[model samples]
Target: MEISVKDLTKKYKDKYALDHVSFSILEPKIYGLLGRNGAGKTTFMEILAGHILATSGEITINNENPFDNQHLIESICLIKEGNNFKRDLSIKNVLCIYSMFYPTWDPDLAEELVKIYGLDKKAKVKTLSKGMESALGIIVGLSSKAPITIFDEPYIGLDAAARRRFYEILLEEYEKEKRIIIFSTHLIDEVSLLFEEILIIQDGRLILREEADVLRHSTCAVTGSIQQVEAFSKDKKVLNKKELAGMMTAFVYCRKEEAVAEGLKAEGIPVQELMIHLTENKGA
Candidate 1:
């Protein structure tokens, strides 16, 4: 599905959760939806999945509005951090409900993941630990096989090993079948490798949207003597700067070739570093 958002805005009284955001997304690609807390990433995703109405502007999935559209809703899935299932329901019952809702639900895959995550089918959801709850959400998101699947912090309470398992399974599933996967996560460095494109939101506004490779190479850190670093930074968009004694490091948004030609050591900025520097408070 191709998703198009134009001037999308969501307001809560005098406050705006999303401020005139607009973007178009093509299907069968993994997108990293990155932002600080309260940056409207969830609001944007909820609007896209038709769970909430936009106060203004519009969104279309393959040229059709998704709001109250059951045909479109079934094709989209949004698995948030918690409250995905009723606490009193057994694991078996939850899966059965999901199977009924999503026509593409894979029973075999769900069963396999239940065993892998150590969730007994007869056990009530209320008795499961936090990590188990997260694991179940992951199972549903992956097994539903929805064309547009959004996972908002899907591995909240998981240990490192279990998180790695989720990542592995995510990659495995994507390799087998291509679909739109919008993943929101705080572990930028760990999960960045899976993203083909990245969207950055800051203060309820869309700040950056670029291919992962292009973004990594878009900015670089140059380190050298104060004079050399400052000289190299001239006329460039500097994202950050630090000085230690006579040495200086300037992270600038410019081509790698430009930084190297200016007689400074250039290092490609990692996604996590780029995000931090871009979103860091300027006044601080």
Candidate 2:
């Protein structure tokens, strides 16, 4: 399965949500789509899922346009942040509706997850708590077993234990049958480790996209005397630098061993910190 996005642009009146974005997803690995609010992550996902059309450019799945393609649409499942179901539908009704929509839906898994989440199948959607609704969304996304499953902050009200359980199930299901899973969330620290590839967007542009492993070993935070830090950063790729009193800290895309050997305190840069370093405003 392959998803190709070439010059994908989505415009609204005078503002552009996605501006000439291009990327190809060929692997069945878990991908992390990340950005600050209004950074176009949701816009891109909507376009990819065929929920909305782009203003210009194109996105294709297996060489065919995803928009209005029933076959392709059925192969893609998107569980959004919320409002995934009608207010009057029962939990069982929602499951039944989704099971018929996806070609690869698994009923047993859905039932098991419903029990694991301790949800009453007969409960109406409007009556369920926020956490229960989120769990229902998770169940749909996971049980759909679609070729491309997109989750856009679907755990809005889930507690920590429930969220962790969802992550574990995600990994387990992925290993059982590898498929494309695009996850977007603000809680990056909790699930960053599961991302095989990470894409960071800033203000309707693609700022960075690389394998999470590469990002993990490619950057480090170094702290020491202001002069030493500055000198160390002279020849290296520094993403961000901060100074206070007589000391400086720099985030650099290079090995931390060299900085340690040179008598500076250095540690691996966290993925969340890396994303911030690459996307934060520069006082324009």
Worst 10 residues of 2 by lDDT: 275-284
Error of 2 at 50 (Å): 0.9
Best by TM-score: 2
lDDT of 2 by residue, 1-284 (tens): 89999999999999989999999998899999999999999999888888899999999999998888898999999999999899999999999999999989999999999999999999999999999999999999999999999999999889999999999999999999999999999999999999999999888888889999988888899999999999988998788888999999999878878899999999998888888878874521
Task: Please give the CA lDDT of all the candidate structures.
Answer: 0.91, 0.92
How would you encode candidate 1's per-residue C-alpha lDDT over 1-284 as one tens digit per residue?
89999999999999999999999997589999998899899999899989899999999999988999999999999999999899999999999999999999999999999999998889898999999999999999999999999999998899999999999999999999999999999999889999999999987889889999888878888889999988778887898899999999888888878877877788988898887877895531
Question: What ranges in model 1 sit over 4 Å off?
Answer: 281-284
Model 1 — TM-score against the truth?
Answer: 0.96
Q: Candidates' TM-scores?
A: 0.96, 0.97
